[model samples]
Target: MKTALALLVGSVMLAGAADAQEKTIRVSYETPPAHIKSRTIEFFKEELEKTSDGYFKVELYPSAQLLGPSEEVAATARGQIEMSAPYFSYIAPVEPLMNIYQAPLVFDSYEQLWKFLETDEAKALAARLESRNLMPTGYWFENPTRLWGKEPLRTLADVQGKKIRTVPSEILQKAVEAMGAQPTAIPGTELYLALQQGVADGAFTAPNYGLTMKYYEVTEAVTKLDLFLGGYLVLFNKRWYDALPEDRQQQLMDAVAASRAFNEENVQKDLAKVDDDLRAVGQQVIELTPEALAEFRDALAPLYGTLDPQIQAMIEQVRGL
Candidate 1:
């Protein structure tokens, strides 16, 4: 009996030591816990821990607790953080090819966006990110974003000179400006106050953001522009990822892939639910007439001509897809 007791204690000690040896990956993103991306990251954490048998653990810092939107890319590249899930456009400053996600009036459907992600142009963009010490795990596509504003945005003429909040992407800025709206680059955290105080007239974002941020209370109408596909790239520090054991690396990728699929499968439903929530609160949801949408599309066409040759080629590749 004493020998059996001694053996049991030894096994318990061994298990404790193994648990202590587990490696941890710290992930940061700029969305709230309620956001679809954040919810998907939660699934990744669960699947990773389960699939790895607790050999790896994930520490998540959502709502920019560990790093703000603008800081995530640089922080991850420098290995200050192990991972980040930021809007693909935010990474464009470092790898200009990533700006393709922000090009207006492209990607009519979620499936179309996924198809482009598998194309050669997408592969080239991934290579560019790797060159910057960032390795992409996967991409989580959000529902096509809509334009929410204080006033209805039905036709190109309605947007003229309206100061609309947008991300810090040259491509997007140019696209909005070409549509006759003055693009204002403001941080997401500041969007509510910006709109309420008249600092900006509106924004282009997903319905999830509208429901999460309660933008419906401030904005009068949301035109289902469905102008662009917005999404997040789950990126890891290349140096850190390269150092991981082969099995651990595969586990990470598998987790990301599973989470990406889960998010994609649920995003359409979530978008619909968010729209329902917005309407329940009395916000007007506008669906532009085909002619009105065409007018806006035509006004923004020159943006394609203004892109760099490489970027323009990539855009064409995606458009063709």
Candidate 2:
């Protein structure tokens, strides 16, 4: 009995020591648990914990449970949390180059966007984030931007005289103008109320937000414009990430790479599912006729010409890929 008791105490002490050596990483984001991005993050947690062989543990604080969406980037940079996932636009103020995503209709597909990300310019853009103590681990795609409104906007002319809520993107503002809609820059926090109060007749956003934010309850129509792809990046606190040993760093990045592939495979299908789910709950999803689509496309054709020649060349290069 004495030998058995000693063995038990020794085992407990060993277990405690192992637990003390484990590193805990907390990742926070605002997406609902059912969202694919959220699922990808959960998968990330699973993969990291599995790959680390008891050396690491990841906890997910989703739907702003641990931190609000607006606080995510700053909190991560401050190392208050080891990581956070927020949209590119949310990070753009601190690192303006990320606003390359702010452009409209520049990327026609996820494949093209991935190609653009591999470019030297995109690499440099990511490198710039390190200056602010942020390191992007992986990026998850949002649905393409859509025009959701209280009224059905089936054609370019139909949107005329309507005020559309949009992000503070110069290119997006020009696109809205080209569509004959007055662009209104509404803070995202107040957007639902703005639509409900008739401050804006429509909004430019991903359909996923309509599902998660319950915007379908306030807005009656969604025109699938497919204007541009939007996505969020998972960021690690640079100090925390940089402090990891080489093999540990590679393991974390490998988990991120797997999570990214999972997200890429499922994101588009999940986007369409969100649209369908929205329709089931009484949101009017308007898929414009071919003629109407052509008209809308043509209306914005000149907007592309407004780009600087260098940017135009790059845009062409991205599209050609």
Candidate 3:
């Protein structure tokens, strides 16, 4: 009888162990298949499954199939979703330091920008996400910011009084105002319609958006502003991540590391392709003159004081680096 009891206990334990090994990650984003964010997540899925020997599986929901950008951060925090890659501006209201990501003309170059992210201050700011049940364990950099419009926006005078769609960041809205355009906050899913319906005369986007999402289809011009580097931070439910075994956690991070190579290589290439593609479709690719760039810089200079003092100081410190 004791032998029979031991056999039953062993059967149940084996079942529980099998269950623990099969972890399913559901990741949602608001971009279509061709966007870099989608591509990055696809690579991450492939690497994670392969490295974990199929013990881990990732399910992706793209083009707002599961949740829109505005809903992702709150839903992920509530554990309504396992993962979501929302823009940093969308995360900023809950995590203030994130607001800096949307602020225009901050970091001077990619080297300086990446160096700043490695600093102690940035890590502490990222740590604050966990307090609200969200974990930013990984991130994907989108293309640098630029303005796309229905008409030529080659100079500050040309931008005046135009209605422009912008991100959820207030600093960016101020930047739009500084450029002399009206700022309207619109979700990515609805941007094409917004432009078509004249809800916005112009909008902000990366070169990838013009190529993949077909923003060039609606736009008449692409202005080179070289605004701040925008990003989509992967926010996982903290509870779900903390419950994972240490090995599993490391496996997930390894997958993110492996998936970055494509984005690092292709971001600039996409811009050059976009310039050619836009002209082929008969749209103007506007380059700002030295005088026009100076006007833009002078307009944006005073807006830096609007940041939270701590975030302002952190940015100032990074610029000096």
Each prediction's Cα lDDT score?
0.84, 0.81, 0.82
Question: Could you tell me the lDDT of residue 130 within candidate 3?
Answer: 94
lDDT of 2 by residue, 1-321 (tens): 999999999999998875553377888887778777688899888998899896788888887788867788899899899888787767877775565676677787888898888888777777888889999876777778888989888888889889998865666788899888899976555688999999999999878766777888788889988878878877889988887788988898999899988888788777658767878989988988989888888888898788656556667777778
Q: Lowest-lDDT window of 10 residues in candidate 3?
A: 263-272
Clashing pairs in 1: none
Worst 10 residues of 2 by lDDT: 15-24
Ranking by TM-score: 3, 1, 2
What tens digits encode model 3's per-residue C-alpha lDDT throughout 35-61? 888888898899999999988889899
Q: Point out the higher-scoring one by lDDT: 1 or 3.
A: 1
Candidate 2 clashes between residue pairs 3 or more apart in a chain or in different chains: none
lDDT (Cα, tens digit) per residue for candidate 1, span 44-88: 999999999988888999988888899999999998888888887
Question: Model 1 clash tally?
Answer: 0
Q: Give all candidate RMSDs, comma-separated.
A: 5.0, 5.6, 2.6
In model 1, the worst 10-residue window by lDDT is 15-24
- Model 3 alpha-carbon miss at residue 251, Å: 0.3
Clashes of each: 0, 0, 0
Off by over 4 Å in 2: 1-22, 168-170, 186-190, 272-275, 298-313
RMSD of 1: 5.0
